[model samples]
Target: MSGALQPPSRSGVRIAGDLYQWLVAWHGCVTVLRDQTLRPANPIVAIGVEADGAGNLDDVIFYRAQPPNSYEQVKYAVDSATPVNEDYLLSPSPTGGPSILAKIAAAWRSLTASGSQVDLALVTNRHPDPGDPLIRDRDSRTQLLLPKAGVHGPRSDRGKARQRWAVGAGVSEQELLELLGVLRFDLGRDPQHLRELVQLLMLAAGLRYEDHAIDAGADWVARMVRDGYKTLSLDLIEKAVQDLDLKQGPARAVLSIATLKPDPVADQADWSLDWTDRFDGATAYSKRRPKAPATWAQLQADIEAAPMFLRGKTDIAVTGSLRQAPAFCTGAAFRMVSGADLAILQRGQVWSTSADYEAATPAIVEHSLGQGPDLAVAIAVATDPTTDILRYLRDQQLSVGSLLVLAPPAGGAKDNSIPDASTANALAVGIRDAVRETVRTAPHVHLFLAGPLGLALLLGHRWNRIRPTTVYEDVATADFYEPAFFIDA
Candidate 1:
């Protein structure tokens, strides 16, 4: 799955390497499509794979006949921390073939023999060694070698290094300079980030970003490569996309608020908020709570800043271990009035909140604790926290007239009760509707939610026509619940 986290140096090197190559090609292919949002103005017009005739490299990017065709050498590294230093580039392959830098220089020397415009790229998921002078001297973005002064002077360390590289490539300093002049060291994102980027590209191209669709695309690309398909064009790619049924409806980029340990899977989210610092990890799957109530305010500010910076991209898929009042506040932050498409990735499935129109209306159960000016609504959609809610109420001495306990029709609500987005949205809206009736009577309401984060978010999204609500979180402890965000809308 493109949305899942890939293994770190897992077994089956052949398949993994091949898949990485295809992913690179597919990314290029998607961006090169006309009018694609991610597309550059001068996108590579065509792609080549194992194209010895086209160019002696792993892949090739052919531009219109004018000049400067790009030859790429794709390197897939199993170890992410491994750096591409002088020793690594100078070292020969297992079969004692020429070193990577030598081969690249040799090809560069050959192609530019006629003085035709050309460029070489070493595309990989590895970074250059910052400590090594040669690799560090080059620009990170341009990847062009820029030796320091006195580099060419005899006996200088940089000079000796340059001489070693020039001798290794069977070329003079001038010849090496020519190669460096046009070379680009394109250090791409790591495996998981790369796949998420690919998915976003697919979404931008009206192509499906679902796991099945991406898998099918990968399989198709692998088959295409095996079949020796060279000179790939847009027409051919469009046909492949159509034949593979990769077309999809409109959608905006997803902003994932990973409040837990990072999302473990490859989700098709473009922007991400990694809030792993908020919690201490118990295991790979379990996490502890935030240290303080101010953390909630900081979280709200963080959530509030997302839409402000995202500009035209607000439609999103919410996921992660963020739950309860925090989740509800997330929905409240990007609420119903935003008019953005919203979905939740929960428990390996994606449920859209917009499907509530066809959902079964859930029954709401309300209670009157006492007569006061304020209201406290305790929802037990995923679990019951009535006892704790009462404890917090008594401890805080909130002037609450009534306490409304909202649940599903069976008078029971747990994580599994709300099966789909439709039911979840219905239940969320039902709770909101039930709260609206009390909003007219009470000047303020204290909202305490206990449910799946998805349900809380949905309720918050539809939470309009409500009172000045102070949403609470069980941050300190279950017995020590505290107020978090004081949302007026």
Candidate 2:
């Protein structure tokens, strides 16, 4: 019941895929080395490549002695010209077996039959085509297949695709959900991009970030795999590092802070400030400064201690979401004057204080809120914070003399608005400059920001010559405001 077409078997494609697998494995080791929490005190761990007994997702495994290991399947394509549409996933594999998608699901079913905590990912260079309906149902955020459903019946195309996939995998609709839930499609990272990321991770881990270092590592990994080694332990890794001339340099400590959502790069961090529990958008969490002085004091104590705790570390990788005040406070903690190098994850890429670029900044617009010592400024980059900021101010009856708005595209930035790292830095610089000029006379600044984490990190990195600022968080249903951390002095 399959099509007649088949791919021509080639060794080069296979070799390239093998190299990618090694690179992925290399990156995993580097990731664990960079994060303290990722490695346990017991230290019974290793990175798995081509896990010998595990047939399904044995490509790259973040293995512990027991369960909860992250499993990834590498699907490398030499030619990424064609996107992985529904047809591609639904088609029979070149091995003349089940459809690619069905096979993936089947592998999940088989792997999870033993009740092991398994997370599966299909890592590929091919992207999902927007033109395909099934592809549209793939949520990029979670990388899960979310099929469109109809009120009375199944949805036209995507729904049908879902149904077909379920039937093909011998699973019911609900079972399909369970299968899709644990499965993530990690697409669009080509060989070169992966290599670059590997190099960057190496550099961040204080390793000798050279192509030759990687080449030596890759050679060691290939030999290990060929000789039937399943997992590479820390001792083995360090031995390779010593044997292959992989020098250890000055390492950069990583900090992860989250609110709205969990930080994606949290796994690669050393220190973490998790306030996601306080993200209840109701109860003025977004508007007014907390009435209790101790609240701000405690938050500041933690934020201030973070830098001192990481005192001697030459660099820091800031990951996670910090609203306005917390971002600035964190930034101010690791300010430029401290001679601390910093880099933040924006969208998906890394924007660093080490890197500089010239790009167009958002147009600054000033608005008068009221006559008071408190001066409000909204950095409206991703979405317009004006409406929400105004609502919070009115509901809380806060006094504001001025509200400066950093408008990215006048109305608001769309999905493609801050497309690159340079643009993100530009916006942050623009907003920081605006604050520098505006906060000269104001004693207390009410800051409201709507932008990516990178901008927030960047703004705080250079948060100089600004007054003591109170950042507000918006609790959705409450329609009130709660002042978060009061940043700066």
Candidate 3:
């Protein structure tokens, strides 16, 4: 939706709505093909044929054997526009002859005559029509009782047209009635469905649009269709980049054909996505990185693999220099693991919080504000006194037990300094045993973490494994803390 489109003049803006409407219908059919249950039944082999774009039908869904698959026409009308109704079934178009109803009949007839079975669907973005023949389907009825007049028993010119359509399709009135059973009318009023479409398109496009621009995904699809693409492809996004016309900038640029140099270290990562908290705080740190392939196929795969909700029990890592670690964790920590990246990380260790660990924790500490019936233990793992945070929790009246594990007395200098991985492992073991000793007396644990990043990661990794825990980081402002973003079990 953020990508460029043809210049937006007054006319283009007006036409955009209509184009988007058609795209919605078209994408609707494409979605059906993606559904495992519906696709196995409908089995769309080809779609959006040349005849469809020429206005013969909005789309022709093909099947393995023949004609009785499906023909769909998607229509949209704004508040001021005319609503779609059964009248279109018999009415004549501006070019004369039969209207939408006649055309659908003709397509059905043609496909049936060719030894195919087909059904007609009129998908509309308008309000549900009470008078619609298919309204009974809304009542959860499995079958539609065919009416005698407009569809099957018309005696006038409209009836004559159906007769002609029947003859052209080589099907009798009874066969037509049987086909009518498959006729569908999908009224579009559910905002949830529209949201799903927007999400699906985001997966297909591999780009995040502003919330207001979700509907614009359809417009992008329509552009791909209008550009003479017969089938949807992941490459259309790249073409969109080339076709973009930025009216508010330099209109022309000098062009020189040149060969691009290959990267010395090719990036193997294929996709990217992020999750945020209600406060507009990102789970991961804000940092720039090399781009990955921005293709729809990869995006779709990524969306399918995304966790439905961030789970509880996770880990976070912070650099030692990030003195205000909790605040950084609040807005800057992130975890993004792609199919390729996951493979690499499993084979080795990678130490960047922004890219590898954004999805590992809850985005904010407020997620635990009222998350208690059980008593909580606030454990501060640091060298110095954590009285500020402890006092703040007490002042806030969060009923919880508290413990402070000060640096060991008469310990080695490394005990006070940042510990290495092995030392962090030993420290993590000690912390886990202490927590195990405490949780037996309490029900839950809320952590106030200090000390080195290695220690934090090691402790978090182990604690999260033991049980789901709430981990907090210290922010810059006095007496404030933010939750670490590691909530998975």
Prediction RMSDs, each to the true structure: 8.5, 9.2, 18.0
Residue-level lDDT tens digits of model 3 in 241-310: 2444211111111111101211111111111232111112222342111123332233223333432221
The digit string of per-residue lDDT tens for model 1 on 101-166 reads: 888887887777788888778878888787876777765424567535125575777777778888
Go through the candidates in order and give each one's C-alpha lDDT: 0.71, 0.70, 0.40
Model 1: CA > 4 A from native = 1-35, 38-205, 209-211, 230-236, 256-258, 261-295, 310-314, 317-321, 363-368, 476-480
Model 2 clashing-pair count = 15
lDDT for position 324 in model 2? 57
Candidate 2 wrong stretches, greater than 4 Å: 1-12, 35-44, 131-134, 146-158, 256-264, 270-315, 319-330, 336-489
Q: How many residue pairs clash in each candidate at the backbone level?
A: 4, 15, 31
State in Å the error of residue 411, model 3.
Answer: 41
TM-score, each model?
Answer: 0.61, 0.60, 0.39
Model 2 Cα lDDT, one tens digit per residue, 360-383: 456777777675767888878777
